[model samples]
Target chain A: MKKLDEITKRMPPEFNDFYRQRIDFIKASIKNYFPDQIDKDFLDRVVGQPSLFEPDLKATYDTIFLPTQEYLGRGGKVLRPVLVAMCLEAYGADIRDFEPVFGAIEVMEDSSIMMDDYIDNSLTRRGGPCGHIAHGYALANVSSCTAFALSHYLFYNNELKLPDDKALKLLDYMAWEHIQMAFGQIEELYWTQSNVNDITVDQYLQETIARCAFLTFRGPMRYAGILADAPPQDIAVLEKIGEYLLVGYHLKGDNLDMSPDSPEWGKVAGEDITTGRRTLLINYLLDKADKQERATIESIISSRTEDEEKKKVVYELVLKYDIFAQTRDLAAEYNQLAKQEIEKLSVSDEYKLLLNQFADYATRRRSL
Target chain B: MLHHLIENFDTEFLEAFEADQRTINECFEAEYKKLSDTEHLEQNVIDEPLLAWDYRAIEPGLLELMDPFMESESHTPLLFFSILRDLGLDPKPYVKASLLLEYSYFALGVIDYFDFHKVFTERKQDLLTYSELTQVRYAAQYLIQYPRYLVIKNSFELSKAQNIALHKLYATIGVTTGIGRGAFLKWGHDYFVSLIREHYFQNSIYTLNNYFLFPAMLGAIIADLSDAQKDSLQKGFSALTMFAKLRLEKRYYENQDEFKITPPIYRDLWQLLSFPGMALMENGLQVDPAPYAEDKYPWFTGLYRDLNTQIQGIDMADTIKTMEKLETELFETFVSELGRVDLLPATVERLRNCYRM
Candidate 1:
């Protein structure tokens, strides 16, 4: 909640001095951002309507509503919306014009989450039973359906006040994003199920970039450009910046699954193995492995292992290739590209500062 | 718990409904004596006026004890509940319970400590509280027809009076937390909502609404909560579904169960029927549907079985049309039970009448 200039001052002094003028650029754009649009009226409507458990009220309470209510009241950082708001500011947007778009993004992100948890079969979330875990399979289905339908209401009903063109464009963009996401998920599932090792590192990286990083960073950046109807050259530059930053995210995102407790993740001075999935690390290792070692790696992975220790040996064998340093250097190269993309933008000096700050945050975010 | 059978309705024939109230009370008195004998349990009971419900509820620290008890595998060898069930204390005679937050544990005041689970408690406490206590009652609710979740779901067609009578059956599910205990005691604050939304909700509303709703009470049972929390919670209807599934689960252990992803679809087809509120069960609790769905529905059932068997190894979309035909047939079957005669025109008329009325 600190003023933009104040927060800019807190950044690395050089970075702050370089980006300080963007305080106005960001401040004007974020003056109207809303994290979530939930209101008392919405809550009341939720109560008044019969739950999927309506007639059987008390039993339903034990089985359905209480579980879901507990989850919502106890939940997350609402980070995706924050990502969207940042992109709007980078484009020098007026916060008033961007509020509806941000709210829509939150609902979209949350609804997708409802579906995501089901896909992952993850048990606990936000310190409570997931909607499905608490609601039972049938009713959990009911809750997801309702959540999906509710998410579209804000935009479709003209309730959020987006302009007709922007609203329609958002619908188009979201639909396309959903298709790419589903496509990426299907690819992942098919690969996992087939137990096939024929997939290339490029395909794996592309799917990860499209699914994990682009939508998180690019979609909102694109949204900001489109809202301002920036010239095509500027839009292209903005997208370039987004793509560069996303590459870094994809390189790091693979290890997100490897817990600190995991023995598979041992100390690696320079060389890192493919974290998991057939990343560039494992692919490089495969290229380097003697035929016997390659065959051995193929046999155990294609089949099942007895435990985590066995899995760690497989991971360790791949680390021998030093593909870890390869990806690390590659990620750094993308970070430089991100810097280059920001410098190419011809926006005013004030706008340039915001762009610089965005580039810095996107690259150094998790590193610091 | 609150003499519900008396205050809520005419239970002058207590001897008839509660054939063993004396034995139930006696069992509880002995249990109380045993609890009093245990130095740890002796401090839990607090004496307060019965009508001062709120005071009586929290005064027991019953919740602190119960919190450890809630996750005690959700079932336990608890005496009061067994006595109540043994005495046939059930919903058909009406039971009501409510959960309220207790004395403020936080000075910040936003967080309700009563609503939160007790994570610090040992697994042994979970053994005593959740797994042992609620699971037993939950198991019984699935196993015993008298206190089952299905019977509660079936109360909709009951007369206004009978509806009230059936509300008490929920008390068994409520018996544990009376104020919810260790609801998710050990569930830490790291997992994300993305995880909750994507992975947890496996079934869609369309599936439940299409297949499970109306005929089954599962939807209504979950819809029973206040509106504020609907978006995130996940619920299942195993309290009824599991009654049958438990038997199936047991058979699995014995290696006698049909091991397949496709559950026996015919159980609902043949057995789903009215609760004892309309028809008495002489021996068992499988709902009998001969009256509502009728013998004619069985031909469609056979067709379904034949279609499933036929389509097992065949192409997926090749069976889509057959599935579509079956879906239509099922729709007709639903309409037929609603007393609609004929198909297209009559179905339209029926829909119109239902919507208009």
Candidate 2:
């Protein structure tokens, strides 16, 4: 599998430098935020009773918690929490005070992935067996709920020592984000389950904005503004920027999923098509393809086969239609809009530069 | 029935209650008329269906929407009105809020129908047209946005804090009912795996709790109860949800697979017993021989036999009698625990009757 650095190396030197610095910052922050060792004592105390399962039930707890631990270790961009910390830093808030918020967001993201992998029946994630596959769906489901509960605990415990009102506000925001993400997820599920053929780009965009964009962009950015005690207008602006960034980020994700360079992507490529996910790429192809082409694509999607041969056929069509480039352009367009939104923000230049660089990387990142 | 529910209230309260009901009816009528007036606007649209936006056009079509897809029921209005009346709040804004909730529910139903039809059911022609699909998609978007719109619309009446809380609660309702419940059903259908009887039964109960029972309890607290009283009753409400789950499970056992799967109302009972776990018990007793029984957990073997025999021979009327007895005991316990708080006696009575009815 290609290292993320290899992908970053492909970008211009300045952009690569910015990206590397951002990654290093995130890695260092996470190291500081989490305990150096998740030893038995730490797990028992922090993860609480789940770690102290009775002898017979120890395996069950391991089944659930170990996969979460494994998946967290096999980290991706750590984008959401890093965004939270960056925004807080930009606002000159005590970034360390908001460690719980960062942890909560990262746990929430990982939990969503666990549940998503289960729901999508994904066999592999980050070049390893998905949580549900390594464990079982039942344990994976339980772990997802546990992660949500832990996020709730982070807020309720108010380890940041925020005022009551501020803590409540943060809790309210997290709840709202969770509900919105669920709504978005349900829409995607509904679309895939229905396997509706007449899907329009508008519908695809709506689902993407809800499922991918809101949590990734709007929610994290808004949370940052809230913690900073920024005015409502500023938070609103942050939300707008986050929305554009989210759309672009989601498009990049879809492009990677369909890319033939599977090992480099570090995920099971073509899982979207094989699982019949309603992607921007699929919607675009449906809109552009001729009748015979449309039928062929539809047949492949509906077949839901994991065969390499069928996946090859679909990938060939994606290439033939230049769907990857088209999607990439759409992402770049959103990234541009995001940059424009950043310019409208009244934040310091440092914050602006950091956000712009992040947006640039999001629109360009080649690997998962 | 409305009068009976609130007969103990003062004349002023009764009049206000009646007026709120009237207002709710009038608002629904106006909304429906607006929907009708714009029906023509959707007729010739070439875009993919924005069914979510043009909800009224799909309102009537809900009756024809098949099983496993939610349909708006008469109980929703009753539930809303009852909660408002019991709380003694000025129902005007809240009634309007309920309409937003109802519309979201309706939109979810329409989306579910489209999804379910696409996934199952071989009738190709009955699938939503492009225009109808657009309507449903738009309706879903509307559903997601309803809480925000409700806050904006009612911000003047509701405090900032109250608005935030209400928005969170309403969003909870939408997610819990639409996605949490809907996804479970879709997953079961897609996998062709037999539903776990426990999950199937408990999920149905939880669905009712989230959609109907919890909202009513939360509404009363928001509208009427003091902060301390609200805290006290929250525990009771949680208890009642558990009771309701047990009640629903007993109901399913009593009914067996006697109910129809279509029309959605009786579908839970049918679906709950459709899992592979229940397959052995579906026919007359046909237990695996001792060798197979030895490999299985001893307790499960015993429990399965007991369930099969009980389900096979149980009298519906007797089972209902037993279930009602158990429910009454649970309700009494809830009322007693809740009575420790300083809520009005009438309010306590209202809580009891709300669930009983």
Candidate 3:
């Protein structure tokens, strides 16, 4: 229920400093890894072209490619790709050499967002019309597939000069992550669609870990491991850390969504409630509410509307139950676990400190 | 007593099988607990109460069907564990492999519940309520997507190539036995009635090949053959298929009157038949025999009598006796081909226990 400014005022100076530095580093890395001019030219030349098979259908290219570029330009945190670069650097890989790989991760993330927004029937993403809304559904669908092809092409034609085996391994890891994420997506679809009320906290954990955590956290970290040829044992540790960190991150996102005054959060607040997404916050509230309160929440969810009044009613119930605090506690627990796992890594102290700080910022950041 | 079939069936394999079964059961128990936890269930309440069944309610009919396999304390994992052990491959990696297979099956069961309900009957409206149907618009989508996740996740143990091959084998079985057969029954149920009424054995046999024999071959491949021996096991699989077909035809004959005369009998018939009878239908046969009445349909009684005559002519008692003998030969042939002479009798006995006919 707290506004972003209020939450920011409550944060310690050191935490703010760490968060600001990370964001700055991420922005600079995006610029360095993918220059603006080259990206535009690449988009124009590759994505902007007419269909190879249907040369006359220039509209297909314009509708699919232009909107994709517009969507990419709308910009996100680029968190996953940043994670890749951080992990690569921590593992002592030359980060500059893996620019294409970083770009591929960003491309994959953007494409997934395009598809997800379409699937969720979301109208706006990052303050702009969703891809399917900007273009048409048919063109958006084609662009989604095109994004994947572009990602694969980036890896296949590795400009990083990775050894043949390492290049293959990188591709394999990317493909594997993509598959795992899709499974998670399917599970999400099942839960949301089925109106399944019996979803437990554990089920929520499993689904989120599969759906969001794998791609957002684990995939990037593991890619870095593969690039650096880190030990399999260390890779395993990274996976656990990724899992915990991502879960915490999702919990925080869920919290931010329920906070009505956080317009800086972008998109829509209470969208999860309106859409009936089975977030940890929703699950927790359902678990804790008494029968009468439970009925009230169920009624709101069943209505499945985005009415401001309905969102306010649900927000009141969430507050009465103290669900936000409980969710934050849970997120803190995971963040702590992630930090513990980070400590187990054989990486340098500086890398460890950076990871711990990032985990803190990831789980606690209130605004850009 | 089951141990007597394999010549050198050691106690370790049994212990290993028991341990793997326990692990898998524990996994399911954990899942079930999450589903059944009142607090969690109460918390998970959505607008659609039925969606809650995703976690909480187990469809009694599906549970009863799955009970034997669930109670048997193993499914594909047990088979994989036993086969991998016999083949001298390390069985450790297969624990995860088996778990993945079980999860895939669990997800498939969820899809099957929706399928049987015809939830997607009105696609546009249903999509509004249950968007998950989009992922599995074609049943083959589940086969392609879910199994690949298992292989990818478990690819740490085997090479990517090996994992793909093994996963493909399982996926193929799912498509052939689950989707392919389910579609056949759904589409051909009316035709099958006409075939039964007219006593069209040749046409029936052709239908049976798709509805029955192919699935039987697939089951045989899963049961008796490894990836390396896929090509070599064709003859063995064919023999097994023939035996399964005859056995099923005999069972159908014995149950023909019940199948034709009583709708409830037909409803229960597939479930009532032991493993061998169901194998013939690829475990997907669901018939409502009510429509094929003698008065309503001209070919009904004649077809019934002809099926009866065919049933009477083949002494199932003798055929089963012959099948038992033939299975022993097939088992021996498979073992010899694998060059695992020591495992021959035990493997055959295991097959015998599994194949009720």
Candidate 4:
């Protein structure tokens, strides 16, 4: 079977600048809003008066935003906001008008990633030390809250002057989606920590729609579609694309995490096995493993074993079953569905091509 | 006088308060059960006995999730109702909001379980039992979002301004909790200054302000008070909250035995102060630096004086007098409308000792 890296597609040169500009725009937006040092003016804006007397402003910034600042500095794809910008362009709106929305989406994504790392006790994120490891766990914990709040603040205080009804709808949508996201995470935790042992690929996909797809895919597209006043049908199309693309994107991530050179891409290879986390590959393996094999896999996962040899054993078993190839094919099917959804949109071919390129970059890219 | 007020709970008033507590607990359990049902959380899984379920292996019960909020000896809900009564407002419509406030407290408690445990064992090799830490930590990730969900879900019952205010209120609660906790972990050698700074900034004042201001802020929003009146209300409550928080801190430090069953952070603070920090501000704690520490390092001396000046400037006698004045001018007439003078002293004490108070 072909390995993941051998089939992995690189971001096209034309699309490289497209992605870079969005990342830069998001980084600039963040810096513009959260000043170098937090002060009364910023505090008054984010959290209104009456201000505290003699607040340790420096301490507040250091404790709250500094870790986030450093983490955002490490730079992921910033694709959620990019997706938002894409939806806006397709709907004939200027992205510049919604800069705060961009900041909100990116910051919320960062906050979730930070919290994920903290919960998983991950050692690294974006190729460096995790926020909790780089900063103290205390700063990381509180910073997550601060960053989450800052995202809402950015959204509410957006300068776009959106109509009240639309604003309210968008706010409610974000909240409901977040609740769905939370439940998805909790359910996944249940499966990870429990002996239920019956999570099918279908069940995992449903969970992924909530856990991975909503925030990463549906949210950005829907935010732009709603803000751009796109018709409900178009919004539905974009949502479908998001759902399919995110499943493909996530399964691709699952496959990549097991690939031998995943470390070159700045993530620990076979980390899913080491952490005993549930993944598409592991689900397939469990379905196929006999009684003894199932017990070994279950024990390794349940114990969250740190032993190198045991992790190697799981890795060998994964190869024995050709699980990575099977998961990769599963991911490709979703990616194809995403492209088909992209084709259904009434936007210009330029927008479609951009989106198709994005899908490729999202699900097929070798690096983070 | 404080003990007299606290110990002598009026029997009729006690009955009324207990009735309120019962009503609130019923609402919490019902809502929680509904939420679990909506989420399809297995009932049998949550109902299994604690010993039978491994903290690491099994998902915690929805019943356990509600336990820290419902079963706590907190008087926040009752005092909130009393304060609403004292303001001449109908408290019935806002019961759900008060319920959300209790859940908000529960959410914070979830975070605090992790925060305090982390701080309590910052330097220890075995920080916490791995399972317990993961369970609580992951619980907080979702639970922290619960109150905000309740607010957004119940938006029809609230005005736009009220909805916005409540959202900001939750965010501020989170930010303040983080700031206060982060301060403790990164507390510098200028310990008192750090502690006092954090307290005023967002630690105690902002944290405790959210609770006192929860009801009052709602009152102001519902009353359509001008921004100035809202600011005035906040200012008044700020001073009161400061005094109340100081009293609570003193009580916390004094009650070392209470630390036995609680998270180790409290005991660790006591040990750290009693040993290396070289100061034990024990009973008869007057918030005076001289009574606690006698360090003569020049920098330390300056910060010590600053801490002393800050504490000394807060004359509790004057605070009490001001509070009495507000009771008469601001609250007495409205409270009289309830025609329950027998409930007054207990209400006053309970209000003083709200969620954090």
lDDT of 2 by residue, B1-357 (tens): 112222233342344356655776777666545433435323411112322332222343222232123333323454466556555655566665655555555554544443333212222222124224433434444344433433444433655455545544554444234323343433332232333434443334333334444445447535746656665555555445545554544545555453233356323322332222333223333433343333211222233454456566644555456556756765665576567774435645654554543
Off by over 4 Å in 1: A1-79, A100-153, A256-276, A299-306, A344-346, A349-357, A360-368, B1-347, B350-357
Query: Which digits, one per residue and each the tens of the lDDT, describe model 4 over residues B142-240?
Result: 555554555666533776655655665656656655565554444432244424433343444554544555656665565556666566666555544
**Ranking under DockQ, best-scoring first?**
4, 2, 3, 1
**Native-referenced DockQ of model 3:** 0.03
lDDT of 3 at B140: 19
Worst 10 residues of 3 chain A by lDDT: A48-57
**What C-alpha lDDT values do all the predictions have?**
0.36, 0.55, 0.51, 0.59
Summarize candidate 2's per-residue lDDT along A1-368 as a digit string, tens digits. Answer: 25566556655565456556556556565454343344444333332211111121222235334566677688676768777877877778876566566666766677668866865667787767887566444345545544444444455445566675776676666554543454455556556655766656666665566555545888889988988888788887898888888878788888888773547566777888867776879888888888998888888887666778888887888888898889889889889989998888878897788788878877776455
Could you arrange the candidates by lDDT from highest to lowest?
4, 2, 3, 1
What's the ranking of the predictions by TM-score, best on top?
4, 2, 3, 1
Lowest-sum lDDT 10-residue window in model 1 chain B? B99-108
Better of 3 and 4 by lDDT: 4
Chain A of model 4 scored by TM-score = 0.91
